[model samples]
Every structure is written in structure tokens, then in C-alpha cells.
Target chain A: MAEGTTDVPIAGYSAPRPRAHGSALHRMARRRSTTALLMCVPLFALLAGFVVYPFFYSIYLSTLNRDMTRFIGLFNYQYLLSSNTFHLVIFQSCLFAITAVFLKALIGFILAHVMHNITGPDQKLWRGVLLLPWVIPPALSTLGWWWMIEGSYSAVNWLLQQVGIHPIAFLSSTAWARFWIIMVNVWFGTPFFMIMYLATLKSVPDQLYEAAAIDGATGWQKIRFISFPMLKNIISITTLFSLIVTFANFDIVQILTAGAPANTTHVFATYAFQVGINSGNIPMGSAVSLFMFPILAVFAIFILRGVTRRTREAI
Target chain B: MSSATLAAGAAAPRRGRRPSIARERRWALWTSYIALAIFAVGFLIPPYFELVTSLKTSQEIGAGTDPWFTQHLFFGNYTSIIHNPQFQIFFLNSVKLTIVVVCVTMVISVLAAYALARMRFFGSQMFATGVFLTYLVPESLLFIPLFKELANLHLINNTWALAFVWPTLSVPFCTWILIGYFGSIPKELDEAAMIDGASHLQMLWKIFIPVAMPGIIAATIFAFTVCWGDFLYPLAFLFTSKQMVLTAGIVSTLIHGDVLDWGHIMAANILASAPPILIYAFLMDYYIAGLTAGATKG
Candidate 1:
């Protein structure tokens, strides 16, 4: 890698060397640099045109009025700050993300441990079955969830009624709606956590566990001392990554609740869509969504730092 | 070592002394099994119910029939949904968008990843990090401005519009995954090719790609699934029935505000979910490997 970078300027400047040195080196260097640039052109173009450009454009959009004809300074942010619905959205967004991430991490950790203990073809079969929810599209799976928890004909409610319990209104009520929303999020997301933790679990040397066993370490002790420490970096990274995703999640909430039961369940992304697109206030929607940036940026910086530190340590 | 000997000693008295240690291990294993079984059942109930409900007659579904099983199987739901003209358009739009987006993403990511992994340009490190950062930028953050951008381009409600926008999401992660894969390739192979007068493009096309086939396939699968499963972009940008992808299309068309045909809705969802689930079934290892590679390597 170092050689590739160093060779370029040397080849480009080789023509200035003694006359005996040929133009071939310079041409080669020039060709290499051009090739590298050419290779990256499409990627940078896409990133700039779509990702980077829209990002800045969103900030600009947020500064505009409802119709977006005129700039209104920080009015959008100021308005959202004062608005009660936006306040609910902010609170719900944080609550939803934190609760869902915590549950997903916990459930996924447990599932990974179960999977780790189960030895044989059964494990592979079980893994395949367990990951179905994550493999399916969120919107589609949420559709299934919607039907299962439909207000009138909830399958779960029906099951409850079978045992002489009254049917619970899964989606019709605010609390149940919030509960089911987070439940579906956890269901859809846990497999990813499971698969990730399972992969990390596999890397923990069996010899270490055997040593722990020889020292009279129980299962929990092994996990606390050996497993947790080995998994600290991955857990932190995956949690933060999942936190960002869960915070910005739209499909589950949108499909399942659509901010139903008086809009109490709306998170940042869904509320942004409701206000921005559904209500035709694109600027406010942009503002709503833009709120995710600062929070995610903080997490992204930490994640990147963790990644680089891990890479450096590996090297 | 002492525990092993103690277990051996306990097991030596086989008449009436089943080793408590062995029993404890069995109990632990059984506990894992029971917990996994319960979770799996709960995890599978929704899709299972969807499948079962999709087979129920409208009368059966409407009459609040058994939620777990259908008395009479009705195949009409699948047929009606499959034959619906609006659904046909949505299906075609989804297929077209997914194919185009996946192709564009793979081409762009592969080239960029090769450059970042092999050729050390002046700002390669920063550019690589930029790619990962782009991956982290959620669709929620970009869709508002992107909607405006598409409107300006007169591409709103155009299925082809997704061909341009989906790459923004796919390329970054695909590039990141490919970088890991490409970086893992023995540096000497590319060096040997370079020494033998292989141009950078030749070295990439002829040497790097063939060796990184698994990574390339993984990236392709990832891109395809992400594009196919995307909801927000289609929801925000494409309004017409003719342009919406499967996810947005199914939700918009199947469920009216007050009246929903649960059978058809379930069928549409199953249909929409089929590709990714099928792809996952066949390439489970590759998918897991790619996912783990991206996560753990970072």
C-alpha cells in the first residue's frame, strides 16, 4: 500500500531525472493515478449527488418555509422546539430507540448463548428458522404483524380470549400500540444481533472455556470474565449501530401504527414523514428528520473511532 | 482438572449415583432447547399466521374464524392478488428497480472498493471512511431532500428514479464490505500482476475480481436485498400505482382506510417477501459471512 502511493510521484517525476531514464515510468505513474481517479469517479459522483448533496440540501430545506419558496432562518427549528407534538416525537423517538435497542441486545445475547450451547445440525436448522423475520422485508413482515395484531381480529387477542381472557386491543390503544411497535422492532432486529453475537461467540477459543472450567468457573463466570470482555467492542459497536438504525426506523412504526391512537406513538422518522410528506410540509419534515443527524453524528464518530482503534490494534 | 477428576469419581458409582454434574449439564442443555423452542415459535407466529390466513376464505376471515387454522382453504386470494393489474405493475416496477439498482451499486462499489483497497490514492483513507459514513446516513435523513431533487429532475413517480437514488444507500455498504474482502486478498498477487505489466484496470478485472468472487457475490446479495426491501424512498418519491415498489405498493393499494382485504394483503406481503427470504435460504452462509465481516471487521 505504501509502495503504491510512493511509486506514483516517483514515476510521474522520473522524467525530470537523468536523461537515460525513459518516459515509460512517468506514463505508468500517470496512468495509475488516472485509473484510480477513474475508478472512484462513479462512487464519488453518486455519493455527492445523492448522499452528500441531499444532506446539505436537507439542512437548507429545513431553513425554508412550508412551501419552501423563502428562507425562514431557524424558524423551523424554533417552531419544532415549541411544538408539543414534536416534543412527543422527540421523547418517543428516544424512548423507542433506547428500549428497543436494550431489548434487542439482551434478547439477542441470550439467543446467541442458546445457539452457542446447542451443538449439531440442529443449531444450523434452528438458526435458519430464527432468522426468517430479519430476512424478510420489514414492511412485509410488519404487514404480517399488522394482521396478527389488528384491532378486531388480533390472533394474539384471540388466543388470549380462548383461555377466558378478554381480547386486548393491540393497535387501538396508545399503550398497546407502543408496546407492539417496540415488540415488532425487537422481533425484526434481534436476529441480526443474534447472528452477530453468535459469530463473535464462535471466535472465543474453546480452550479458554475449558481453562475456566478447570478453575471451577461456572457458566456465568465464564461469560462475565471471558465472554463479556471478548465481546465488549463488538457489543458496543453493534449496539450503537443498532441504536442509530432503531432511532431512524420508519417501516415498522409506519406500517404497524401509522402514529395511531392520537399520534402518541410517532417516532422521528414516521412523524417527519407524516408532517413533511403526508401533510405536504416538506421543510418541517426535513427539519424533523434532520434532528437525527446530530445524535447519529455523535454515535458515528464514536463508532468510527472504535473501528479505527480496532484496526490499529489488529495491525 | 480437579473438576474433571471429581466428575469422573462421581460417575464411577453408577448403581444409584447419576453424576449431579452430568445432570446439571443436561438441565442446561434442555433449558437452552426449551427457551429456543419458545422463542422460535413466537418469532414464527406472524408469518405463519399470514400464510394460514392467506389461505382462508374471505367469509372465514371475516367471520372471525379460527386464527390458527383455516377450515376451508381458499386459493383465490393468491390468484386474485397475482392477477391484479395494479399489483402486476408494482411487481414489475419492483423487479426493474431492484435489478437496475443492484447492477449500478455493484459496478460502482466494486471499482471504488478496488481502488481504495489496492491503489492508495492521496485521500483514500478519508474516502473509504466517507463511504462508510454514507452508509450510516439513513434514508429518513436524505429522503426529504431527495424527494425535492427527484422532483427537480422530473423523475418523481418514475420507477427509473430509484435506479439513481438506491445506489446512494447500496454503494456505501457494498463498497465497505468489498473493501474488507479485497483487503484480505494476498497483496502479492496484485503486485505480481503489476510487475508483469498489467494495467491497474487489468489487474482489477483479471486478478482481483475472480479471487474476490465470494465478497462480490455477498455484496451483490446485500445490494439486491436492500434495494428490493426499501420502503421509505418508494413511499416518499413514487406516488403512482405504476411506479411504486412492492413494499409501498402493497401497503398503499391493499389496505384502504376502513376496508382491508386481509387475505389479499397477506398474499401480497408473502409475495413481496418471497425474493429476499428465498435468497436468504439459499445463501445463508454467504449472507452471514458478509454481515459478520462488515460488523466484526469494523
Candidate 2:
């Protein structure tokens, strides 16, 4: 035995060393090419056992009617397409996603710029405080929103009343309900935009700004020519990712309203859970949920390819 | 750091006769500040309003005691909910499920990420990308099938159902993150260990696991947070009130049908959210790194 080495291996009788055993494990472990695949088994087993199987199973389940008895291909999809309930949910989902994404991006950008400009000693503290909504779980925060917007005890409504304005039914009325959901989403998601923009902003060469400043560039000119262009890719990537997330969002909607005020607030996700899980009509719910996948898949493809491209470029 | 430099940069200039451009920039700065303050208020008010409501009793809360005005802080709600067995079970279920899922996710993701990062075998890249894109498919799309499969396995309504199903969402993102983190680790460390007659598994257990501890921690936080906060999967799977995780338990059972129990509901919501909130407060850097790793690497 070498100095500082012992006959007792660290793993210690877990298995005979592959080299000593002269088995396939040795061949697999010694070769880098083979090692990767061998290592992949545990992870791949997880995916195969859980993700892929469930995914394909859901697709198959949707084709069948309730109770998994008879194959009724296209019936579930066609029904979902033709139903008035489905149309309303789909429209609400798009409205929710679009409104949330735009507000989050706009507000996040403006905040990031403000934080960048301020000469405060406690900048990190401000950023952290601003990030509170994101850090706290949505279920909690949104539940809080649910309480605050209580039809009778609504703080917002009371405040409006004090100002001589009519008390709006935030959670009870369809229009006010929709507005509040979008508003909550912007609160939760803007941190992501802020973080990404701030990170990208840190890397912008100060020289570009200095040169532009020297050339008598106004603040708007500096932002347009220097800052915004540099942030374009980060902006695009962040917005695209947020869109997919907000589109399929179940948490905010579920907690805030549970597709309430006569199901006017139903997104595809909540609608699926409502009809499928809550109501116990599994196939129809599966059909409703699958509606968001294809649209999201396109977004995923762009993101994956973009990541690969960035990695290759960096290398 | 930058701010000090900026202030110094401004002060170092001539004392008298501030330029027209500088005055114009100050105007822009103030305007931006106003816009930012208004936007921040939009972001800040609703949740702050909720906090105030949660602290008020039903009577005081309903008495319309000036919604914005702080009156009679009701911390008893927290204690009341904490004393409830149902709320306690929900908390324990959530904590238990999050822990087990995070462990399983780290194990699966580390091994898979190691393969995707270090292995150059055929189709590895494609497989890696596929895993992440699978993750991108919303939980809604998969939960129905997952519920059915779990039901077939007789795991439905079991809190451990999350021990089975959460990895469907978690593993992909976790794997994506670990691959990015692992890819950044130098191959020399593993190669040196391998050349010394160590098996790949040994290298992973002794060398890579230690070296990749930060990445592992990052992935663990991500896994835990995702599992902890999930409402949809738990709602879809768990049946009995006792088995319900925090998110679904509060959403479904606490609210009940047609009768909203505001006191218990708010208290349960606050209690259930405590872990993730604390985790985020401490490990913000790791949290952001884990999120962006999934986004950037996927």
C-alpha cells in the first residue's frame, strides 16, 4: 500500500472494483465514451419511468372516453374545440399571458434602469426588497391577494371608496377579476426580467456609454443606441420564456379565483384541473391540458437551440 | 460600487456653471424616478394590502377600518392555524414531499447531467435537449396522464405520489442545470482519478460530487422550491385531506366548497409558504443561477 493509502477502499465493499472483477462495468467505467452512457442510466430510467411514460400515457388517455374504456379518437379534441367553455378559457389564457408578459417586461426594464442609475449604498437591499413577490411562493402571495380583494373587506375597494370612487368587484366581477390577475402576474414575474436585464447590463462595456456621452448623446439617445441594443437578446429570451410560463399558469389563477365568477377566468390549465381532476372526467381534462403543449414546444425549441448556439459561440 | 464612482465622476467636474446637458440629464433622471416609483407602487400595493388584511381580525377586517391604515395587528391567526392538526399535516406533507423529491431529483439529475456534460456518446446532445423541452411542456399537459398512471399504480392520493410524479417536471430542469454546471467543471479532475484506477462510479461519488457541490446545492434548491410550491400536481393526485401538500391542501380543503374560511385559509397560506420564502431569502444567488441555468442551457 502507498503512503496515505489503505487496502480499505473509500466506497468499501460496495462492490468489487470493476477492474478486479474484469466485468462489463470495468469496460464501461474505464472508457470515457462508455462512462457517459452508463452514468445516464439512472437519469434516463427516471425520465422513461416518469416523464415520457406519463406524457405518452396522457396522449393515449385523451383519445379514449372517460374511465379508460373505449377508444374515441378525435372526439375529446373536437369536443374541446367546439365547446363554449373551452373557447372562453382559451381566450382568457391568451389575454392573461399577453397582458402579464408585456407589463412585466415594461415594468422590469424601467426598474432595472432606475436601479442602475441610482447612486445608493444599499442598492442590493432595494433589489432584494423589490424581489420579495418572486421569492415568496405564488400560492401564499396570491392567496393574500385573494384576501385583500375580498368583496366586502377589500382594502383596495375601501381605498377607492375613501377617494369617492365606486368600489369595484375585484374578484367578483369578470372585468375587474381579469385585471387583478394580470396585475398580480406582473408583480410576480417582473423580477425575472429585472434580474436578466441587470445581469446583461453589467456586461455592457462602459466605454460604449462614455463614447456616446462624449458625442453629445442625450439620455434617450444613449439608451436607444447603446443600452437597448445590447440588451435585445436577453430581452427576447426572457420574454419568450415568460410567455410560455404565463400562458400555462395554473397557480395564480387557481389560487386567486379558481376560475370563478362563473368560470370567466378559466385558463386552459385551471380548466383542465377543474374539469378533469376536480370533476373527475380525466380524458376531457387531459385533452384540455394538451392544448398548451404544442405552442409551448415551439418556444422550447427556440430556447434549446438558442442555448446551444450561445454555448458553441462561447466555446 | 458603481454609484460611488458615478457620484465622484460628477463631483470631479468644474464646480460652477453646470452644463445644459447635465441639467437635461437631471430632468431625465427625476422623470425616470417618478415613473419607477409609480410602477413600483403598482407592483408593491396588492401584496402589502394582503399582509394588512391577514393581520386584521374578520370583524376589524370587515369593519372597514380604513384598508390602508394599520389597525389592531392580529398575530393570533398565525398561532391559531399553527395549532390546527389539518394545517400541521399539510405542512409536514409538503416538507416531506419536498425533501424526498429534492433528493431523488438531485440523484437522477446529477447522474444524467454528468452523462450529458462529460460523455460524447451518440445522441447525448439530442437527448439532453429533449429532456429540457420535455420539462417545458407544462405540468398541466402531463398531470392528467400522470394521475391516471399513478392511479393504476395505486399511488393516487398518496403524498408519496409527489415522490413519484414531481421528478417529471423537476428532473428535466434539474438535469438541464446540472449539465450546464457540470459542463463548466474541468475534465482533468475526473481523468486524473480514472487514471489512478478509480471506477467512474467512484470518481463520481468521491470526486465529482464534492467538486460539483455548489451545482448540486443549486439543483437541490431548485428541486425543493419547485416541489414545495407546486399546487397543480398535488391537486391532481392527492385525494384525502391528510395527504394533501400545502399548496393543494390550502387551496382545496381549507377553502372548502362554497364557504371560504378566510382566517384558516390565510394562516395556512402564510405557514405553508414559510419554507420557500426563507430559502429564497438566504439562497437567492443559487436560486437565480438555477433558474437561468435551465433557461440558458435548455
Taken over the whole model, the C-alpha lDDT of each candidate is 0.86, 0.77
The CAPRI-style docking tier of model 1 reads medium
Q: What TM-score does structure 1 among the candidates reach?
A: 0.94
TM-score of chain B of each: 0.92, 0.85
lDDT (C-alpha) at residue A127 in model 2: 70
Among residues 3 or more apart in sequence or in different chains, the pairs in candidate 2 whose N, CA or C atoms overlap within 3 Å are none
Candidate whose TM-score is highest: 1
Off by over 4 Å in 2: A1-34, A119-121, B1-41, B257-261
Off by over 4 Å in 1: A2-27, B1-25, B257-259
* Model 2 residue A306 CA deviation in Å: 2.0
lDDT of 2 by residue, A1-315 (tens): 110132224334435665554544445434656667877887778778777887788788889888779999989999989999889999999999998999899888878887776546555656776777787678778877876776754766777787898877778889988998998888889988987787678778888976776555767888898889888877877888888999999989988888998999999889998988888899898899888888888887777666676667557
